[model samples]
Target: MAGPSSFAARRKVKGVQLTIMVVGQSGTGRTTFVNTLCEQPLIQHQQPVAPEEAHLESGIRINPVQVELEEDGVRVSLTVVDTPGFGDQIDNEFTFNEIMGYLERQYDDILAEESRIKRNPRFRDNRVHALLYFITPTGHALRELDIELMRRLAPRVNVIPVIGKADSLTPSELHDFKRRVMEDIEYYSIPIYNFPYDAEEDDEDTIQENSELRALMPFAIVGSEEEVEVNGQPVRARRYPWGIVEVDNPQHSDFQRLRTALLQTHLHDVKEITHDFLYETFRSEKLSRSLVGDSMGAGYGAGQDASVNPEDLATQSVRIKEEQLKREEDKLRELELRTQRELAERRQELLAKEELLRSLEARLADAQHSNSSTPLPPSQPQSPIPQQGQPHPVLTPHGGAPTNGLQ
Candidate 1:
């Protein structure tokens, strides 16, 4: 029923919509990386804070910025959700909850919309397709914070770990760091989004490309906004006293490969996985929880309705119970760990206090001993006061006074 011009206009207005959420601590080049990837300033650099206000907790802020971009002659609608001050606080548990809640809320929105009798024509799907977690370039294994965050959120989003400000480390250091990070991820069973391809089913080029990208897991990112002349051509690079680090140089960093994979090659795959797996899983769990709750409230016998299969309902109920127990166990484990850390810190503090007390006692005892050991100089006999007209005696260098003034 639509005319050709109308169809063309609708196609022009509706391009591929992709939402990416970036999470990292401040000073990890998150903003610069987003800007560099977009080839324009999408996120403004955080303003410098005053020293007095530096310790204030700003809490986590979720900001979504929409931008239209063209990649490989295809119009793309991109939404970047930036989580500022995610890991800035001393306790990041709340921050984790905030981020997790945001992701699940998107799913909840979709669920509510699906349940509606009539669909809203202008509703937008803002579910985040991918999450880029910028790991701090510590040149060491992944921190507990990193492991915990990715572990908890991987079930909900496509988490891609990347090392930010990676130019700070040497090539060897970077390689070692990446190896250690991947090892930690494996050890902790963190489900990060690794570029996946089937060796038998996928084409050779696809397999090779994916394998290469997977090997470069936790991509090394060196982003810069400034341009410098390289071979008589201006390139985006961070100038240093020793050399220049180019953003697009494959040898310098993995920015270009990551950009291509994220925007060009694996974009559809990421979205498909999000909808097919993550959202579906969430929806199943949500519905199961609701059904289980209703069944329990009404009595177990009431669950054997004609419309629903008893076996499926029982299976869902058992699965939901297991999930609840697993979540509780996780919470208990986290609490125990936190308590142990606090106890250890308190023990250290007590030991330090005892040491200080002993030191002070020793110093006090030494002072008392010194004062008692050496008696004050014996009182000197007062010399007779000379009369107003009498001459004063001149004391010799020795202990005896001069017998006469002339002497």
Candidate 2:
């Protein structure tokens, strides 16, 4: 038993999983950042397109790559999903739906699995825990595309906004850029993951840590696969004409802090939020829509068509749910009234039985009293005459008339 228990514990420890998706335009240094974060060439850089073929639209593609990593002595099965050719098209409106569809598809898989009578032994959960949206280093504010993508996707995933290639701007410019981006997000009411913590419910260290991380929203990122010798030690740094920028240095970039938070400090928190909140919310909306569709007959079944507007579907779903709830409440109230009526009828029957019992007892008491109060009659003498055509009366030896009957 001890051997098997220990083996199972080890197996569980070895299977810690985390999925992250990177989304941004092509030149935002997403590939470099991922490689730098993983300390390997996990993703191959795309080839440069020819000038003649540059006009072609490739659309959006979602590619998931899995790798094994060890962080803090725990084996992590990490899946990095890359969104290439996003926001690169002329319109880019359909790209949002593509990304959203992919995210919801994973949720749909889990929902289907949950509804199954028999569970699949080899089920794999590919739901993304965090999304790192790389912002191009513009030294200004968020673009319309950035705002739109984040705003649309924030409700479905944990969006951690980061500026790719932070070394392109001055320190002051980078600070102001971060401020403006956060302001735009606030103005738009985008629900990005902001390192949430509760002061009253959390410990002092947690509150402080989360507060600091929140202040550093839209982390500045610098990525390099090259290593350079600095101060008699080799470190990952990007060489430049004037000075070298170190990837791990706090003064240079927020890469190290972001890495630590993603892999070590808050990995479990990210996964928990994804499963407990985001996924559950989606699951509920989906099930509500399905239920509403089924209850409203074939018209709602046809409403599931993609040609129908999404806002209309949402409105119909809410209305149906409200009607269903109202019907259930009415049924419950009727049941309660019926139960009260039955209880009242039972009470009346019991009261009638009690009254009848009381009447019977009174009658019985009266009969007993009459019998006890009455006295016996005096003894009567029998005549010594016989009936006509009858035998004469016989006497006992003592000359007494027969006591059996009158003579």
Which digits, one per residue and each the tens of the lDDT, describe model 1 over residues 28-91?
9999999999989989999999999998999999999999888875788899999999999999
* Candidate 1 lDDT score at position 318: 76
* Highest-TM-score candidate: 2
Clashes of each: 0, 0
Kindly list the per-residue Cα lDDT of model 2 for residues 189-303, writing each as its tens digit: 9999999998789999999888889888899999999999999999999999999999999989999999999998899999999999999789767766675667666577645
Q: After superposing candidate 2 on the true structure, give the runs of residues whose Cα lies further than 4 Å from its correct spot.
A: 1-12, 301-407
Predicted structure 1: clash tally = 0
C-alpha lDDT of candidate 2 relative to the true structure: 0.90
Q: Top model by lDDT, which number?
A: 1
TM-score of 1: 0.71
| Candidate 1: 10-residue stretch with minimal lDDT | 298-307
